[model samples]
Target: MLSIEPLNQADIPVTASLHRDNLRLGLFPKLGRHFLGLYQQSFASSPYGIALVARDEGTVVGALFGTTSNAEHYRWVTRNFGSKLALAGCSAMLTRPQVALDFACTRAGRYAKGIARHVGLTPSGSSGPKAASRPVSVLSHIVTDVNARRRGVGRRLIQGFASHATLLGIHRALLVTEEGGLGTPFFERLGCRLVGQHKSQDGATLREYRLIFDEEGAYEDRDGGRVAYTVVRAYPKRLGPASTRPQRP
Candidate 1:
């Protein structure tokens, strides 16, 4: 049986467990308790952050979690991080270690130099002066137990997330995930169109996509706020699916 519900404390253990198995299978390291604890906290914090679980029989097989920052959240997040901050230098390196070592070093240097010219590291030329006035939502997490994959659990989770966006009156939602995975196909099926792709040494690719609802809500309209997009990336490097003719199950 499959069930969809808002996530609560009780579901954290199961959600984290599923998250663990899916990524570690691809040579990813197991997350320590501290990270897992933080993960749960962040997942629950997003104003529109929501979770849904799919169960096969009595076992939890999949989960979807995401967030949408409202006007208030956009104000808070931007005020602190302010456009073009320097603190993320280490994270940029950690996430893209596979690039040419020299290139990575140069990019880091460039990232630092470019900061003064850019506000909030945002694509918009303006980021600071328009903080609290805008509303944004960030969809942050999604995972499925490996053993239960290929069974539409992922697709259903996407639907659940869309439903949340619909409820929030958000006409659109954003999330980034590993490219060409089960999750990709699932999102595409649900009207989530691919917006862009970013790649790095670990063979990790961040694919950003947006899902727009029929008539519920819309994204943040603040002056300098941003669109919060959930990022679901944690997979082992592997040969992509072959071009072999499709075989019906």
Candidate 2:
């Protein structure tokens, strides 16, 4: 039987390995060790973080990191992930300078924009959902084990995460993926609609998809079964009061 559970500390190494082995995002495989851990920790340590893992016969087959508020999430990440990234970057520089340099250069623009948003130079809605101030949920670093791809692993993982968001009163869950990538169709099939498109710093096009739970109370797949997964939320200890967004199942 497959089960969804809150990600625990012991699961990190295996889940990180899964991300390295399966996810094909640019620079992910190159700095998989450091970057995956950083992303997971950024979410895990945040007050708004919602981390989950899917287990089959005691092994992790899929995992995801989510947050109810990007603004608060980014603030925590900026304050906490900086030193760790610098240290990791320094280590990569010594062994693989070219790869390290390329990764750093590519991320320069994103870091600048993040800073602009934090400092208020990039106004809300300037970059659409990326800068939206309204209550929003971010789905980040979602991946399924290559060996377990088509057995409903990804769907269960997403449904589990979305259920958690619904419990927290967040209606909009969004993620960005490379255009024409496997994730595009996967997310679309789960009822996430394409909302916008933008170019990455390296000029690759990316599409943003949003699953509005309010509009999609429960989705009917082509087979006519309602998508469903059960998630048990640990008591939420948010950094602030919960969002005022209307709750919907």
Candidate 3:
């Protein structure tokens, strides 16, 4: 049967490969291996992030990657980076409106951060508009292999995280996905409702969604066992057991 678990040292290559291949299929950075490696390093090492993968027997076939973030966790990116983006856009307009067009997408990407960061512009002693705050659980990202689509692999991987979050007693689980893409409908059907919509730093529009979870849910793999994949990640020794072989076809 297919099983899901957190990604660790052994699964790096699998996560990296799936991430790279997905990028090639139109995800992000769209860069070659060099940049992909850089991304892998960050993703693998980030304590705030987690990657869950699905295996059929011993073969790695699907994955779901996510980052853990609190409400204030967006400070660095939104305030500083996004403010720079807004400034750059304004400067572009003052000099060349055409150049400003280039930053239109950039500003939109930073809009959420712009909103978040501006709360700090006022002096600390002065009563200013408070930064937005609310109860939040760990944030995450998710992906599945294209070849393995529609057989419930994505569901398996995502549900794995849901179970993990529930066990951790995290009441809310949040994630972002392209609003109109394959993931949109998928998440919606799974009971995650849209919470917000925004543009990306690269001008792509995205939707944020969340779900209230109970730890009692069970995650089952529909793949029935090992799923085939062009690439695979290694198992985290700290996790329970290594994937096992499926019955012969």
Candidate 4:
């Protein structure tokens, strides 16, 4: 049986490993599995974060990490895991000069600005009056094991995420992916609207997608199936054996 539920502490290692192995487009995976583990931990521990996993029997096959408030979540992560993440990142840069070069070329300035804003060294830009009417959650990361593809794991995980967000009174969610990337069509099929396009610091074309929850209390999939928004609670018992190996999807 396949089940979708909130991520738990024990699932961190598998989730991190899956992230490191499967999601290779960004800089985080190059930082190594330990760094990814702490990254996932930050999400699991943050009040504004949402972490969900899809499990078959007892092994995790897919995972999703998001935040209700990007700004607040960044601050929470910086306050709690900044030092550890910096150390891990430094270690990665030392061992892999290419990763160092990539960071310097791409993320250094953005990260610096984020840190400055987190510590109040930089002023947050004006929110304007319309900011109150816009409550957009972020869908940070989502991935599924290769072996689990075509089995509805990704769809269920997304649906479960939407359901959880709705329970939190969040009706809008946003995500960004590389333009024309493998996941782009998948997201489109799920009814995400293309809101904008921009270039990343690394020069990759990035596409922004927004998903709006309907007032009728259900989200319609591409197949015309209407899935009601309802949270899938975690199982009371711990997971079983951990021998299952994951393949990239």
| RMSD of every prediction | 11.7, 9.1, 13.0, 10.3
What's the lDDT for residue 237 in model 4? 13
Off by over 4 Å in 3: 23-28, 37-44, 71-135, 215-249
Q: What is the lDDT of residue 209 in candidate 4?
A: 83
lDDT of 4 by residue, 1-249 (tens): 999988998998899889998886678998988899889989889998999999999889999999887878888898888999999999989999998998998789899998988878888764654553445589999999989998889878877777787688776678999887778887776666777999877688999987654333223233334454431112101111112223212
Candidate 1, 128-217: lDDT as tens digits: 645533345546567778777777677667667766765665555667777756667766655565778887434578788865543222
On lDDT, the candidate that comes out on top is 4
Model 3, 72: alpha-carbon shift in Å? 7.6
What's the best-to-worst order under lDDT? Answer: 4, 2, 1, 3
| Cα-based TM-score, every candidate | 0.57, 0.76, 0.57, 0.83
RMSD of 3: 13.0
lDDT for 40 in candidate 4 is 91
Best by TM-score: 4
Clash counts for the predictions, in order:
18, 0, 13, 3
Model 4 is weakest, by summed lDDT over 10 consecutive residues, at 231-240
Candidate with better TM-score, 1 vs 4: 4
